[model samples]
Target: MKSNRVSTRGILVTLCADESRVGMPGRAAPQGKLTGIGVKPIGEVQWQLLYRWLYGVVELLSGEHFMLEMSHLDSLCFEAFLQTFAQTYPHQLHLIQVDTCLST
Candidate 1:
């Protein structure tokens, strides 16, 4: 925008995005404790019975949201998501809002 002229587009979009890469329920973190009368958990292993992964975002301007279930958290998944999003949105811009910290 110039000093004397203001410019706007037809539709400018922003998004608040997030992802969850857990396979099964209660697998990302332990939901309960396994205590047995002062028993130690030295040799215990947390089972990651995984299944599905998800990436999601909500459009801040429209309150609309989209969720995609992908394989896992890797560059391949991210690239694929970018391709799909570009194909669907077509030159639209987005801002993901995960872990957003602003310092002065």
Candidate 2:
């Protein structure tokens, strides 16, 4: 038995996402004194690799497409994106597909 509730908003947003990274700062150097310097990051991480991600969805009913870009991707970033998407499309359902491994 299911509840007799149907949403008037007829949109199923299916999103596919990919993340790519670039500009890793020329072999990367440590923020602190180097112990024989072999590209080891010690102490606080001062440099970050630039990352670009694209998450997009197309609404079949309305033919509307939206793509989102960000510098990096993490649990925090994912949450923020979800919040923004929800605020923007309060009535639409979202489906996100991740195609990359998030760096730890």
Candidate 3:
């Protein structure tokens, strides 16, 4: 009997970015001080399984916000993040089949 197996030729990729304020109650809250960028598989299961391998974080001062403005260093970090994503591509592709059709 022939072996049943599938090879992973390619995988789905996704990129994400967001910013939020972080500070203790006593300390002054900086606007958009924390930012993160990451790449991961499209599905929730895969993302949860391996999110650490593809992400970057940056701390910015009050003057910086991701889209409206970005420092030169921030741009470099973003470039590095893209490079990391390309370098750390997933090794395996997960396939899922769903059956939700109802017969009339």
Task: Give the candidate number with the greatest lDDT.
Answer: 1
Clashing pairs in 2: none
Which structure among the candidates has the greatest TM-score?
1
Clashing pairs in 3: none
Q: Which TM-score value belongs to model 3?
A: 0.25
What C-alpha lDDT values do all the predictions have?
0.60, 0.56, 0.31
Q: Rank the candidates by lDDT, best first.
A: 1, 2, 3
Runs of candidate 2 with Cα error greater than 4 angstroms are 1-9, 22-52, 58-64, 100-102
Q: What does candidate 2's lDDT look like per residue over 4-47, in tens digits?
A: 12134445555555444544454344545666758764565556
Which residue runs does candidate 3 get wrong by more than 4 Å?
1-10, 19-73, 90-104
Q: Candidate 2 — number of clashing residue pairs?
A: 0
Stretches > 4 Å off in candidate 1? 1-9, 22-48, 97-104
Judged by lDDT relative to the true structure, which candidate is superior, 1 or 2? Answer: 1
